[model samples]
Target: MKIFVDRDKCQNHGLCAISAPASFQLDTDGELQYQESFDDEHIDDIEDAIDSCPLQAILLHPDAA
Candidate 1:
């Protein structure tokens, strides 16, 4: 899957990081950083991250069928 974050809408809340540290992180500046694509094994973590994002900035896009 592909992950996207609306940087303009992110507030650096770190919920995404908490939910999926392997895929999402808060940088030294406390900005959100994440992998653009992740393995299927990480889908559940990514989903949790999407749900945990307080600002709703995280988005997931499955590959085109």
Candidate 2:
């Protein structure tokens, strides 16, 4: 699956990291970081992250569908 985050819309809220720590993270500077590509097994967590994001900055590529 492919993941993309709209940096301009993101607020660094860290909810995505809480929802899917394996795929998303907040660095020491409280900035968001994530994997662009991940294992299919993490789909549930990735979806959870997407749902939890207040800014709706996360998106899955069409290939992820």
Highest TM-score against the true fold, candidate? 2
Tens-digit per-residue lDDT, 1-65, candidate 1: 68989989999999988989889988899887889989889889889999988889999877677
How many clashing pairs does model 1 include? Answer: 0
Per-prediction TM-score:
0.89, 0.92
lDDT of 2 by residue, 1-65 (tens): 58999999999999999999999999999999898988989999999999999989999986634
Model 2 TM: 0.92
Q: Tell me the spans in candidate 2 whose CA falls farther than 4 Å from its real position.
A: 63-65
Mark the regions of model 1 whose C-alpha exceeds 4 Å error after superposition: none
CA lDDT of every candidate: 0.89, 0.93
Residue 52's lDDT within candidate 1 is 88
The Cα error of candidate 1 at residue 43, in Å, is: 0.5
